[model samples]
Target: MKRTEAEQFTRRLTHHGEGPVWLGHHGLAVLDMLAGDVVLIDDSGAETRREHLGAVVAALRPRRDGGFVAGLERGFCLLNDRFTVTETVTCWTSPDVRMNEGACDPQGRFWCGSMAYDLTPGAGALWHLDPTGAAVQAIAGIGCSNGLAWTRDGTRGYYVDSLTGRVDILELRPDGAIANRRPFVDVTGEGFPDGIAVDQADGVWLAMFGSGLLLHFDRTGRRDAEIAVPVRQVTACTFAGPDYSELYITTSRYGLTDPEAAAGAVFRARPDVGGFAPYAFSG
Candidate 1:
């Protein structure tokens, strides 16, 4: 498939912009992980406000009752409409490790992963955080856990552990349980996979950090298409717009001697394929 193109959408550049999420009433949001800022972008793709969480904010998802549930440094936090940290849970007591990436399951549970500052081989773990403030360890013994997505049926989950260079499939049970881990896609190459999103057609749009490409893989784990961004540190992406056909992406300028104008700017593209509306965090 031919590569799709995207244009810069935001004026603000992040030092390490990572996760991009679409909230209808809130517009779009992207995080400068290390800077602890949740930057909101308007529908016109303009930077609106910068909400500081004081610690590394890896990812975030909307709460069912409004507000948001976020993956913060070493734990999880609840943010209100004012973007203030209301309730906090310290899942990891270690100062060296911080939240990395995550998303909500179909059951409305927030699942987040963590990694060490030095990127230790097995210092990261994945957890299932309940809205009731329960953080349960789901999977561990991994490295750089990132990019999570689920199938339309909610029976299968896809995940990426950058260290493994493969995307794994998880068995998602109706009772909100995950099991039967197996490799789904082997993206062995120069760069590790960063973030991912799923569309209505079960196509997985994954951001490849070093490759500067967002790969689209079908349910069968075949690379069907790809989108090219102007930056080399593309991080995460999600479907936005009313029909969820617009792909909002995030990138970083963590390590670049000379970067382009779009290095840490948010980008958007109309892939011609609609995306799935993400499940809200019930807890």
Candidate 2:
């Protein structure tokens, strides 16, 4: 197989950034796992970091009216207009899990996953939070829920469990419950799947952590394209820039040796692919 080519965009400090989502009409939001913070990086590349959040941050998404919402290792929190913590939902009670990856459904529901900190399989669950702040565990015994995306029409939901090396698709019901759980894709060899994003054409871009490659799959999970990066621990990616043509990738140096540390940096590249508009939490 031929090597995939990729171009670097920008190099910044983000230790173990797991989830990156674009804030419509604004900038980008990232979850810093080491600092346990939700950081907002504007269009100019200036970042405002909210620190000392919790154990570890797993995912972040923007609220419709401004502010943001983040999921941490311990629970979930709401960021107010001023980016302050307005409310927090802890996960220390039942199930004893940590938040992993999450995204807002088309209907404005926040869905996030929880897993054990030790990378133990079958020790986590998927949860959903409604507009009114009510939280419920939707699925249990999830190994490591990592990537999340939705179809264009908002009728299908795709989720990845890293440990299983499988991506599952579900039919989105009217009541926010998922049905028809089936394997959409299976990745073998080299890297494990970490984060994902869906394009306007319904293509899925998956970040392969250990392989240092981003694999693009069609709606049916067939390999469409691949892009290479210098970093071995690329955690997540999203479309940014003026026309939403540039793909911004976030990487990490966590668990890396000296050689790998040098390559742990955020990158950008134009894949000649069109991405979908990011979903905002209007509720």
Candidate 3:
């Protein structure tokens, strides 16, 4: 497939912008991971407001309760309508570890992985927290756990451990857990893969940071298409347009110089195929 170029959608800058998600009327919400902020942006790309959690807001999803389930610096949080921390559950105690990218399964169980601030190899692991509040270790020995997306039918899951240089797939057991881990596709990019999304056709669109591209992988794990952006730090991507044909990408200006004007802006693109609407956290 030919490489598609993206256009700037919004001009909001993020030190480490990540985790873009669409919640219909909610417009778009993204994490300024290092800034410990979750900012809401309208369709016009205006920053509506931001919630400062005093801790890194790594990833989050809308909850059936009308709030959100989120991964924070040292634990998971349940926020109410006012964006107040109604509940906070600590996973591990060390400040060295921080939450990374995460997404909810069809059953409403939220899964997010963690990594060391120093990026210590094998110092991170993926964790699953169900609505019942039972947290389990899904995968161990990971470095820089970055992205997680599930298939439409919820039988399979995809993950990116940026350090591994490949996207991995796991069989989602009936219990809303994962197993049988294996490599899905190997990738060569400038800064490894970041966040990812699955289309209605199960096509995987991955953000390749430092490479200024979003690479597309088909169900068979073959590189089929790619998108070129203006900046090197393409952090994450999601589908949120009218018919879900518009792909929204999040980027960062962290450690960047002579950067493209749109480096920290949200970029928009139209793919031939639309995407699957993500399920909210039913918990």
The digit string of per-residue lDDT tens for model 2 on 112-158 reads 88878787889988887787887878888889888888877787777
Candidate 2, residue 185: how far the Cα is off, in Å:
1.1
Q: Each model's C-alpha lDDT?
A: 0.86, 0.76, 0.86
**What is candidate 1's lDDT per residue for 73-115, written digit by digit as tens?**
9889898878888999888788988889899988899999988
For candidate 2, which ten residues in a row score worst on lDDT?
A: 1-10
* Lowest lDDT block of 10, candidate 1: 171-180
Cα error, residue 112 of model 2, in Å, equals 0.8
Write down the lDDT that model 3 would get: 0.86
| Candidate 3 local lDDT, 1-283, one digit each (tens) | 7788999888856778899988667778888888989888898889888889867998988898798888988778889876898888888999898889999988888989999999899989998788887777888888999989989888788999989998999787778656588999888545678899999888899999888999998999888899998888899999885677889899988887667777778888998878867777777
Model 2: lDDT equals 0.76
Q: List candidate 1 stretches off by more than 4 Å.
A: none
RMSD in Å for model 2? 2.3
Q: List where candidate 3 sits over 4 angstroms from the true fold.
A: none
